[model samples]
Target: MREEENIIVGISIGDLNGIGSEVVLKMFEDPRMLEFCTPVIFASIKTMSFVKNHFKLETQLHSINALDQIAPNKLNVLNCWKENVSIQFGKEDLKIGEYAIKSLSEATAALKDKTIDVLVTAPINKHNIQSDTFKFPGHTDYLNQELEGNSLMFMVTDTLRVGLLTDHVPVKDVASHITEELITSKIETVYQSLIQDFKISKPKIAVLGINPHTGDNGVIGSEDDTVMRPALQKIKESGKLVFGPYAADSFFGSNNYKSFDAVIASYHDQGLIPFKTLSFGQGVNYTAGLNRVRTSPDHGTAYEIAGKGVADLGSFEEAVFTAITIFKNRTEYNTLTKNSLAVSKRKRFNPKN
Candidate 1:
């Protein structure tokens, strides 16, 4: 494991035209973020300058030629592209798409090389970036492919954490995708992440039902009875604390969600609708089961309020803080594990010798 002091966080400036730059700038303005980790923005200096001037922000920006030059109390800007991107505020353009993709690619490369400890991505426009060069549904799918496809999308807040069984899929097609293998895999990913990354021992997970009232014992839908129930039972047999197929409608209302550490929703809306209702302006989208830690604000590009300076950055703030916390926790967990193993080896070998 690498030393915690060397942890550099790579941040992708989402769409240059959107609030991505604004949030990134706003986060840097708070001096507290620097104390936790060094943040390296994978964006061109020109784009950041335009944002700062347009918003009249009082934050300092430093353009660096190499990753080794990154330091504390400085906003490290990695100039991945040399093109001068025009600032259109809320307008979407092909140029913004190109720039966003460029920043993400460079930051992803840095993460893969272990130069960056974690990644915090700003929201990107799905429609604008639909060209051949950039053909990803969203950041999660894009990062999944880039990192060899081992990842899960999990929404998190201080009080609640929820993982999706199937993300960005149509509601009608959601049931088709919910097989025994898929549910089991997602459950295991969420389980392992809670235990290993988040440092939760014996995390309790609540799995939501696909149909109403947990399919009512096959009266409404058998997918919950046949597919979800069986898989969850198998998981429980493994001694993991998992419960549910609970009615999505009543789960949040009854406050049953509070009993578990995390909830596994059947689809996007099944999980996000209630989560957003509860944590609308302060939710954090976390990508679990990845080789490198990644997080993003729950909100979108907010194109209408791009340059207004009225974009409430509560969610972005939470996302940034969550990334730092997770990074620190993981670093500490790895250190403790290493120390325990070393001590055990010494004790065993000393007695044998």
Candidate 2:
């Protein structure tokens, strides 16, 4: 594992036409941020300089041709593309989307090769980012494929953590998607992530229902009784403290979510609506259950507020800090587990019974 002090955060500059650049520049403007981790932005130095000049930001930049020359305490910009790209604030441009993907792809490569410790991505335009080479709905979907493990869109903050059982799936297909296997796998991912990533020992996870009042004894819908309950029961039998299929309508309103370690919503909006409503600016979209650590601000490409110089730096800063914290937590967890395994092997091979 890399040392705690020298953690390198790989940043993907998302949607140059949106508020991504603004948040990224604003977050690193304060010299104090470098004390936490060295930020290597995966974008052209020229593009970043243009953005800096437009934003009138005083934060300095260090341009590097490769990751090996990354300097400590300086904002490094790795030139992913050298071509001059036009920037139009608040406009959906396919050319800009290509650059966003380029940044993300290189950052992900660095993360996979251990060149960077973690990744904190800025928001991207989901619609414009579709092309022949890249066709992911969002960052989570793309990273899920590139990374080692199953990805869970774990939206998190100090007080709350919400994971989705099925993300980026349409509402009409949501019920058909939430099978017993899907439920089990998603809950297991959440459970393991809590222990390994968040350092929660014995996590209690709650699942929101598919239908109102959990189908109200099959009156509203039969999915809760047939699918969700059985899956939760099987998980419970396996010794995990998993509960729910609670009414999605009143789950957060009643503050019942506070009783659990993390809540797994049935779908995207079911989870995100409450999460954003409660912790919008302060939340981080943490991609949990993957081998590499990655996080992003909960809000997406704010086209309306692009280049306005009024974007909130709260969420972006929170994403950076969250990425660092999770990286350290996972490192410590791996070390402890390895030591435990070694001890177990020694005990098993001992001559004395």
Candidate 3:
């Protein structure tokens, strides 16, 4: 088996008008990062140059025309589009959003074709990227559609990990979507991810209640008791380390989320608000349950900080490392489980010796 040190890391340049380039360039600037894996950035040469010069980034932007031309131990930029892209830094433009989609589309193709081992996506604008071909809420939704597998919007840090039971849905619709079946399914996916992807053998998963104070004992709402609690009970009865229906309000503030390996919130904001606050908005967003490994920085496009040369590279760098780690761990796990029979049946032959 090939060592993970040579894993090709695929990157998608997000909104051309945002901090995607700034953080991405910052990640590649570190020479020591190249020792871990080869980076294949799915962005255009023109867009990169504009960001590099605008931010005065000393980082080298090496563009490789094709996959065959990969430069070992160097950050390689793949020209995602045949046409040129004119970047308008910190400005919301449809053209720039389209360019972001172009980068993502090409990177997705490369990932599917095994040109890259894992994908680390930069942030993209959810509004401007809407088009005929792309009709999903965000990266997680789009990836689920493309990969045809269940996906969990999992946010991870050094110690804390959070997963959203209902992702990219409207606030009004969040309650209606949180059914017993879904709560069970989403938490199941989270549990498996914590085990297989992160290599946590006996994962302890906690679920947060939907309403305030866990529906205040059916006063404000009842979804926590009627839906989530039942699902948790069923999952636990089936021999899973699942517990929850805890109030979302005091879950993080009281440090209750730290007790479990991963916490599953009923909705997006419920989980992400506390997660970003604790992790300082530098957590890695991992799309779990898919066959392929994909991760992104927790923060958004950050139009306010675009081209300022001040975008924090911590989250993006962590996302890259997390992707590599998950890919390696999953590969190793699969080898141990799926290929054990083949490996055990064949012993080293020494007839000639």
Candidate 1: residue 343 lDDT (0-100):
89
lDDT of each: 0.87, 0.93, 0.86
Q: How many steric overlaps are in each model, in order?
A: 0, 0, 0
Worst 10 residues of 1 by lDDT: 1-10
Cα lDDT of model 2 by residue, 1-353, tens digit: 67999999999999999998888888889999999999999999899999999999998999999999999999999999888889999999999999999999999999999999999999999988999989899999999999999999999999999999999999999999999999999999999999998999999999999987899999988999999999999999999998888889989999999999999999999999999999968999999889999999998888888888989999999999999999998999999999999888988998474
Best by lDDT: 2
Residue pairs with backbone atoms closer than 3 Å in model 2 (clashes): none
Per-model TM against the reference = 0.94, 0.98, 0.94
State the lDDT of candidate 1 residue by residue for 1-353, as single tens digits. Answer: 45665567789988877888898898788776677678899987887888888888887888987887787767889988777878788998987888888889999999888788889999899888778777778999988887853588899998899999999898889999999999999999999889767889889999999998888888998999889989999999999999988899989999999999999999999899999999978999999988778999998889999888888878988887788778888777778889999989999989875
Q: After TM-score superposition, what is the CA distance of residue 105 in candidate 2 from its true location, in Å? A: 0.6
When 1 and 2 are scored with lDDT, the better candidate is 2
Order by lDDT, highest first: 2, 1, 3
Q: Per-residue lDDT tens digits of candidate 3, residues 33-133? A: 88999998898777787777887777776888898787878889887776767776688998888888888888888888888888899999999999998
How would the candidate models be sorted by TM-score, starting from the highest? 2, 1, 3
